[model samples]
Target: MIRLLACGALATVQDRGRLGALRWGVGTAGAMDTLALAGGNLLVGNPDDAAGIEIQVPPFEIRFEVATTFAVTGADCALMLDGVPILPWTGARARAGAVLRLARRASPQAWGARSYLCVSGGIDVPVVLGSRATQLRGAIGGHQGRSLQAGDELPLGSPDLSPPVAGTGLVPPVVALPLAVDGLPALRVLPAAEYECYRPVSRAAFWGEPWRVTPQSDRYGFRLSGPTLTPLEPLELRSHGIVPGTIQVPHGGQPIVQMCDAQPSGGYPKIGTVIEADLWRLAQAPIGARIRFIETDWDGALAARDALDGWLSAARRALSYLRARSTA
Candidate 1:
């Protein structure tokens, strides 16, 4: 068990998200930076989709009630165990009564806006609708359907093996060593159905200029502040199915990139869809950061996704092999 000594401003329990429920009007609520969640889980030998704490605020504090292995991934939130500084995306064991604290972002170069704290077997939150992730919009699932607070006692899944060595950890290459173009990280996007509705210059500017993430952004969507994109003419449509990464242009002319907690359907005009593999980059980008969008074909998008899947598979296999060797 872990005691929430001091809950941050916006920390919640999350898993791989409640998949296949969009048809039922439930958005897929999950970790913003999924790669970080998977990295933390893999470090501790837990399933990649296992439930963990998704922390957005800093100076978060927790007290371990029992000895167990844990991993911290994503943002370098200046993690310290019992007051000793520890590296992010690293694994370590905590003794009973040990206190773990996370402060503000340590550096500008670090990648991520949110940090994940994954325990060995995962947080023992009751599953709701095929997921332990918090559905904040609907106020369902995850620790009584709310964000964690001070004085809350969160249970841990039963450990089947002893804690791994303190040095065991994995560095996510996606963040530590990012792929860049012209010294700027970019997200690949596929033109959506309404792409042609926009003026030719608007479409050109979308790709040619950089967009800044506004402070109004949250889990629901990122409201971008950039060149005002104007359609060739006013258009209207009925509410239709939409998914995360769908860039919707509202009447205000700003583009909102739908996120994990976005509604299943929307009426806004979608101009493009950020490819699945590059969505993580947008999720981890800090507010006020400028992001460039790169246009890609369907084949290119598929190839990018396949490359990500390959990396995850290789990481899982490597971690599994190390575990077996250690036990042997």
Candidate 2:
């Protein structure tokens, strides 16, 4: 068990998110940076989809009620265990009553917005609709189906007796599998159903210009500030099913990228959809950050997904080998 000493406003318990719940209009409210969650889980010897804490608004502090192994990943931040600095992406053992705190990045230029804290046994949140991920909209999953607060005590699953060796870590996915455009982070986008409705210039601008993530962005969607994307003709579409990564251009001409907590259906026209493989990159893009969108096709999207799978597979194998050597 672990107790939250100070949990910022947006921190929540999440796993890989609820699958098949979209049919019931429940959005997947998983970790914003899933690669980070998976990496942290690997370090702590948990399954890839194990539940963990997604720390968005940081300065989060927690105390272990029992001795346990844990790891922190995602945004590069100042992590301290009992006031001693612990490196990001690295796993370490914490004796009972040890306090762990995470703060803003020491370096101003470090790129990332969210972080993941994974333990040897996952956070023992009850499964709802086949997932332990927090569904803040419906208020059905996670701890009370709301953001964590100070003094909240969370349970943990039974952990492996032979835990992975402390200090094991992985090269963050951002560094290991980089994707950028003109020196800026980028997300590959495939043109959507309404792509052709936009004027030629609008289409050109969408591909060529950098879009700034506005302050209005949140778990529901990223409201982007960029070139006004005027359509060739005014469009009015009926509400239709959408998913995370759908880029909707509203009446204001600004694009809104649906995120993990977005509604299942939307009425706005969609210009493009960021591929699933690059959602993690966009998830880490901080407010006021400018990012580019690389135009891609179905084949390119599939290829990118495959690359991400390969990276995870390799990490799993490498961690398994390390655990074997440590126990040998």
Judge candidate 1 against the unseen true structure and give its global Cα lDDT, from 0 to 1.
Answer: 0.85
Encode model 2's per-residue lDDT on 237-305: one tens digit a residue: 998999899999998899999999999899999999999999999999999999999999999999999
> lDDT per residue, candidate 1, 38-71, as tens digits?
8888788787668999998876899999988898
lDDT of every model, 2 decimals: 0.85, 0.91
Best by TM-score: 2
Work out the TM-score per prediction.
Answer: 0.96, 0.98
Q: Which residue pairs come into collision in candidate 1? A: none
RMSD after Cα superposition, model 2: 1.0
